[model samples]
Target: MTIRDRTAIVGVGTSRFSKAPTDTPMRLAAQAFKSALADGGVGRDEVDGLVINIGWPLGVDYDRFAEALGLRIRFADQSWTHGRFVGPTLQHAAMAVATGLARCVACVCGVSFIQERGLLGGPGDFEGTREEGGTHEENPVYGLTAPAAGAALSAQRYFALYGATSAELGAVPIAFRKHAALNPAAIMRSPLTLEDHQASRFVVEPLHLFDCCLVSDGAAVVLVTSAERARDGARTPVFIAGMQGMRAGPDEFLFATPGLGIGQQREFRYTPTEEQLSVYRMAGVTQKDVDALYTYDAFSPLVWFVLERFGFCGLGEAAAWTQKGRIELHGELPMNTSGGLLSEAHVSGWNSIAEIVRQLRGECGERQVRGARVMQWATAWGDSTIFHS
Candidate 1:
């Protein structure tokens, strides 16, 4: 039986985001998990499975975390994706429930990098290391160190073809920060101007400091149960309608190949736009049905790339759409309603997932959108992509 319609998210919770935390990662995760359980009207004893997106500088292990929580888990495993683990984790939890392996599954993500180091230096330092034995080190060494650098390459190519400028890229972070200003949990909620984005120092050429996301410490958790049981619990259930993941090839192969960039790429190119379309197809939905969007914004350029990839607009037209305030809270599509990674504290994009849940539940106090039925969340890791609805 298809798991697409079998599971629903009944509980979602998150700790306040911050660049530096006075609390530990485990404590943050525990708080979020407890909040989720309370939101779902379930007890910790009812959680049959525990899933964590593990990998951080805090030296916290999954086994240790489970032990600390005192959960007698039947299924316990950690996700390996750097920042793109949220969607797949939810999908895996949904599958577990659909297949009778679990009744209630809890997925948690925690980050304390900012508490360890400031914005310029933290968690991302060990991004591409090999644990046992591996040899895929070329692309990462050549300045594709983090998601921001890799996305900058795509941004440069996008500008070349679409005639978009760095200023257009500036608008994404600016818009997100504006929304974040209303979120008390956000770290950089102050008003930001295009001049601020253009004036920020460059982390990578064409990708300014403001264009990149903040390194933060926080935790978020979600509870998934069978769709049949979701409405029996707290709040309205948001069904897990669809999900998909795709990988093209090594980063160099997709980036260096001729006719692979934005407008220059061949029809149905191996770009973000095509990847998003493939996800929409898998979800059995259309762009018109997507009332809200939470595209990964580790970097500002990713916003445009994902918009084009999901067929929201033609290649290179994302900048125009964004500039026209079409993505603002009152625009054609309200995006990043919870401030997003750019302005809100970045908990490795886990906060983005929580924001999507809030939008679906109509719980967003200031940045809430009306009639938000369908929402899309996308994340790109290395050269792989994952999407959820």
Candidate 2:
């Protein structure tokens, strides 16, 4: 009767992090899909369901991808959320299998964001709309074009309220980049310091260039099957444990609203803390039980917010936690051991799932955290948040 204990990730795969050349989105998807199949020790014919994120620049059609991959799929669909879609996709796949709608599900996403012909460039040009319209465009015009801007504003507010410094924020990117230095698959592997982070160009005030995640061209796919059938597959099975998503408000402007006097916004939630706490409680695990952490680091401040939200530290105490080296490898809680999107290439947060699988399988090379039994991965897009364990 418990959904958390029933689903397992049997296979995980990803393309090398780099720029997409002449390859089309479908081809990129095929490569990732094949890699996942090979990793899972499952054949393409065994795949009964397919799910894809429709947020990338190349615009993936579920039917087109299934046909091109030669998969006879019984269930196929596309996700709407941006980077936060992966967890939901996995949830859907698990339900499909658990309900006998499909036996094996392949979830995939391909990004051409780093290419010259990418979605960041324009719309219809890509799968999603480029121009921010309706309530969505409200904040972007106020200079919140990218996610970092909104997060930076939050960072500013956190600092203003807690007396935290930018140096504390710098520690996250510095640590992640250092970890990436050891990860061969990472794109930004150079050693980083608080000085380096402070010196980096300002993407948005309070957020340096290094605080932002890279927009890279790549694709990643994972295969999900029944937990009972997982042991027969290629790799160790990482159980779903639990998954949840919460939307506090619509559009990006909600978080960016400046407080109007003492108690103007009494019910407004400024961060993803409540949603994250709910997921952790639902999963029946504590932050102390987690061996590793992979939070969406599209902006550096997010690390702090996640740390507080997930009960790693008290509210307004994330800066102290980072300053004490609690989040570094060999520390109490190692975070972003795969370099995360901050140091590793960003594939719309799919890489977070791949990294979690790698840690669970004990396949991560130099950046691996030893004896990692449980992991926490989170994603945030606009006002929506998704967490998986």
Candidate 3:
């Protein structure tokens, strides 16, 4: 279905992003959902559809949540395919509202410390799974079973190909930390220096501890409604201008796993592909038209890789581009104005999306982009969405 301007994100809200959140997942989600409703000037009875995303060890039924909220919805779903379901969930809610299957839909997602710590036991505990083989089955031999191992390998290969230095890679975290300093909601608000990023211990060689995202506990909820309904809402509605989702391709896997040094090895990216060009075409916007950018940054290199895939710069040039300060606020294009996943909270990309809404609505005080008209959000896993006020 054509998702261009059919629905609007009328309200956005987020719970505290922290390492030690005391509320249960359900309670946290409810708090954010209610805040979204209030922001939209919507009532609980007005909601006709519900969507929820939860991580491992904290699975909550959508139906039960609807019942608890006293919402009799026409449709409800739990989106938990992988950890990267935020983009897809938003797309699903937009389609529902556009097609009249639901008048108003709430997309809620959150994770708790219990899940991150693996306090509640599952099939195999978090640490025990490391000994087992990973998806490739040959991962254990290379000691590449853990995610950081793959990231480290990718960074090494990327640096070798582009002659990018670790200090150049440090620029990513530095810019994010600068933006985070302006955001009161960000967990890592302390001033950060490139020297500090380089001095931090390496989780995997070339990937420092500062390069990784935090294990945050929080919930974020967004309310989507038809354009007509949103026009009358309390807050200025941010339209869902366009969306595109894609996955890894043969070239991507080859680059990630260059056996015998033979594959499409030139390019290095967090995901195998970027399907954002089509989204921009559908929305009738261009890279230059975007007033602000939010790229998913679970790791620092992700910003560089995705910038290359999205045609923001040539492959291997992202390091130099970042060093030039194009990503900081008041630059050519401000990025992660809310600190992103690296310094901000990592509720997947939910908080990033919220920042976009706030920016478009002129709600962001110190970090606000003046007269921001269009904002684009890209996930590390080949999902992209654009929003405009």
- RMSD to the true structure for each prediction, in A, is 4.0, 3.8, 3.7
Model 1 is weakest, by summed lDDT over 10 consecutive residues, at: 132-141
Give the alpha carbon lDDT tens digit for every residue of 329-380 in model 1. 8888878877888889777677877777777888888888787878877543
TM-scores of the models, in the order given: 0.87, 0.87, 0.89
Candidate No. with top TM-score: 3
- Per-residue accuracy of model 3 over 28-131 as CA lDDT, tens digit each: 87888888888889988899998876644553467777877888999887764234577878888988998889999988875774455443223333432556
Which pairs clash in model 2? none
Q: lDDT: which candidate is best?
A: 3
- Candidate lDDT scores, in order, read 0.70, 0.71, 0.76
Task: Tell me how many clashing residue pairs each candidate has.
Answer: 3, 0, 0
lDDT of model 3 at residue 332?
85
Question: Least lDDT summed over 10 consecutive residues: which range in candidate 2?
Answer: 255-264
What TM value does model 1 have? 0.87
Cα RMSD for predicted model 1: 4.0
Alpha-carbon runs more than 4 Å astray in model 3: 55-59, 113-115, 119-142, 253-276
